[model samples]
Target chain A: MDDMTTKDVQEPYTKHLLHYFDGTSRYVLIKDEEVPFPEGKLIVSRTDLQGIITHCNQAFIEMSGYTEEELIGQPHYILRHPDMPKVAFKDAWDTVGSGVKWHGYVKNLRKDGRYYWVYATIILNIRDGKPVSCTSVRRKPSRTQVDACTALYAKLRQAEEE
Target chain B: MRYVMTVSPDFPPGQIAGWYIFNTWLQRQLGEHIHVELYSDFEAQRKAIREGQIDLIYANPFDAAMLVREEGFTAIAAPLSKPDEAVIAVAVDSPIQQVADLKPGTRIAATDDPDVNLISMIMLEPADLSAQNTQTQTVGTYILVAKQVLQGKADVGFFLKDAFAGLSGMIQRQLRVLVRSEIHVIRHVLLVGPRLRERHGDLWNLLSEMGENDKGRDALKNLGLQGWEMQTQEDTEFMIDLMDTLVN
Candidate 1:
């Protein structure tokens, strides 16, 4: 609450109208302005089996628009944009469960209801021969990658809604 | 209580069994149930570290900083006389004699070995080449990096100095070393996390005396190491500080 920055969003706010996998959807404003991902910096985070954030690096905190104290112990879907198709996370969980790494271009919503695109790679963390958690590192995706993901995600989102 | 020990993944395929032998020797000498878990890359290994899954680790110089500072891993020892080094090379026929001959748009093929890539990038600073300016291609292996340079697909290749030396003689003759990092202070170190803190002293003493016995000496040879060099906390902090400086 105190850590969140409620930036002034001029774009009219819109509701999901139909929602799933999103928990406690507080910020409903979807600004058309995109926050540019910083160069030469990596956003890294770790989550428990339930996808609750356990640790986050400074770069992640800066880009995510949420303070460190607020982010930890919260579900990672806090950054989930309604525009993101649920299938992306479903595919991630399905593949990562098999000890495989998953990589995709994603548009993550910031605390201010702004968005940024990243090339994210996630891997399963194992303990005593058992899977325990997940670690993800993300970097700025190229313009071409962002453009392609935008088109593909739009189609996927439309399909999910219909 | 079974502890999990992991090694850096950059070791040669020939050294896979060597690690197992070393692990077996460690368990026998320490009188503990220690299992070896092998991760194919740094991402997985780092994840395990963050998740508190790894108890003991043989880490690269780049990761040593994170392990000690971030994960509370205490440094114990390093392979005697083995310093991890990096080399940047070009094809023998290429006119690039020194690193300064490199240009901004030069295509550089490299592996994801963080220490090697970090030092190699610093070396390229003299030539005004950088990740922002250079066309960098990440190959799967050192040999593939060499292949990229030899086939003129990349103007330069970055490699682990040891891996480059391990290349076949025929291939070695085809490439020329542009520059090799001489930061001799950096080396792979064995570290124990908080869970294994109590056994650190016993483990260090055993490694120090490992060379006295034939079986222990044999295990060392299998891992391509001579002996163990005992490390103090000061030694570790200095090295990690150096690595932090270099990384920035």
Candidate 2:
């Protein structure tokens, strides 16, 4: 096992490691800063097999409040907020699963039970033959705007859980 | 030289009467030798301006405001037309009868253009009407929204009075205006390129000096103008104010 150094794990290079994933063949960098991601801003990552997180940057860990020890073995949904509707995530997965980038707003919960919003750009990672990991970035949301969104997410989550 | 003047598709295109006529009349009156081509849509017109493919333009007030503010274009004149207003509408039999009637959960078919419809909604009335519990689903356009309302697909819709006027009689009959906005000046402004300012000072002078009887009067009339009038930055501050208020 190649131990990836924190410096080596930093962006502008960590993305290259995705090529080492089993059956991984290609990667795409989804870029956008429009909605203010706040915790160092950019979300650069790679994945393998059914949209899994193969590599993420320090910014991702800080924004998500997850230690690398806990994040490595888990799917991204560990951060999913109870307030978020499963359908939104379903749609996001379905979209990227089809091998295209989808741009939209997402409501997520932090490790502390606090909620955050992100203007997300999700891309499909295709290996030589299959999907591996899915990655995302989240940022703070404007309080004034998120009230309506929060309410909507509550309803969506209710429907999903039902 | 020949110049193309791009206008919004909100109105008809081509060499029709009203504003375009006035613009043509003004161009000939300036007599520095110029031709004006008219484009009916703002997107196409804006592309022309961005590409430096056109030397002059007659843009919608919002588009003009952006050009003046962002691109440093100079405004030679703006039509005297009153600003276009919008109306939030619901089915005639719907329970929504007033602005206060809207709740947060209400599904409103609105355009994705935040600057125009969404910001305008906030500027016109800044309240958590949605707090009462309603949702706003942004649709592609007002026309699709109108169809949605008619087919009972949406609870409410927002539309410009001018645009709603042209909808089919069947759809028109199904809707009722719940609230109409305060009159806003959606003027058609004539602007010169920034690079042309010094070399075209004489042309601007000609424009500023031309009167109703000037040969350009026909073009001016086509463009829906009475005559050219000079305006300072202060003249357009209200638009900036509206934009700033919405953005903030």
Candidate 3:
């Protein structure tokens, strides 16, 4: 049994270092724990078109398990969970690239190898009819919606791998 | 104060000339006491919203959702449209039958409207046609996309189902549906600003009930839409979920 604990991960801020193990190497971190979302709070971040973080709020920094300095220049996908299907991101890019707002449930991996679910609202900042950047506002997702998305994402992943 | 209303330029500048005529009739029905003016520029509409100068607006589902969520506006009603109502079309004689048949060099045409462009991109996903792979021509309107495909200027076109359904017989005969997207999105929507809803709920109710009433039905017919129906919680939620999945 892998008994990696938070204390064991002395260098928790390192990008590729891990403190949790899910028994499978497919994911960078283990989903051994779930993070609790704060009530009536929002996790907010802004990214360039390539998804390099430009700015993020304190709540986003706290929930993401990354310090503000570590997150600012990093790609937003650093927190992506392996369980997510590529199709969802494809649809999101297609929608937002065309200058429309997109909403979806996302499961994000934490720096400590835990995970949390959020209902994310992403809007592209349009300048001269083209997207210059994107802003995302995230709130805690309902259990029902999370369960529904998990099943749907599993199906999508199966179809994708085939 | 006169209420400000804006329309999306989903249709080309002069093609749907009836829109100007229809909004004029709608303003009269809303009563001269509630003066309404119509404009179609999206940038101008965004400006008005940013400045809190607009009162009511008729917009695509994406804009309507954003306005309601971020701009102190509320969705009151949406036009009657099927959830998954966008269709990709090709010339009837073309060999392209399914999404996989689309090649790297194939010419794609779509309206400049954001909804149409996004739906077309989503529809093309199955073919793995990314920005690096395929090219797109932004035609002025849905009708022009159909015309472009039919005239062999483009290999495939994207348009709303209603636009294709209302095309001229000859043009309709020349095009065939390549695929219909499975993603459901709301069509046009009606939204009222916060002040309008707070201080003039009765007036707002009167406008909202127009679709179910007699005079409102006439205006709807002229506008080429069913009467406005109240936006349900389920509908708003669906759009919100769809918005995240469909972003570029």
Mind giving the per-residue lDDT tens digits that candidate 3 earns over B64-100?
6578677867666766664436778899999998776
* Candidate 2 wrong stretches, greater than 4 Å: A1-162, B12-23, B32-47, B110-115, B123-145, B165-171, B183-188, B198-211, B214-221, B224-229
lDDT digits (tens) for residues A109-128 of candidate 1: 87776789877777776544
Ranking by TM-score: 1, 3, 2
Which rank order by DockQ, best down to worst? 3, 1, 2
Give a tens-digit lDDT track for model 2, residues A90-122.
787778778666655566544433445765666
* Top DockQ hit: 3
Clashing pairs for model 1 are: none
- Across residues B131-220, which tens digit of lDDT does each residue of candidate 2 receive? 235566666657887877877877778776656776778888989977665434434556777655664666667666655354655455
Candidate 3 stretches with Cα past 4 Å from truth are A1-162, B11-41, B81-84, B182-185, B232-234
What is the TM-score of each predicted model, taking all chains together? 0.61, 0.48, 0.57
Output the better candidate (1/3) by lDDT: 1
| Model 3 TM | 0.57
Question: How does candidate 2 score on lDDT?
Answer: 0.55
Interface RMSD of 1: 11.1
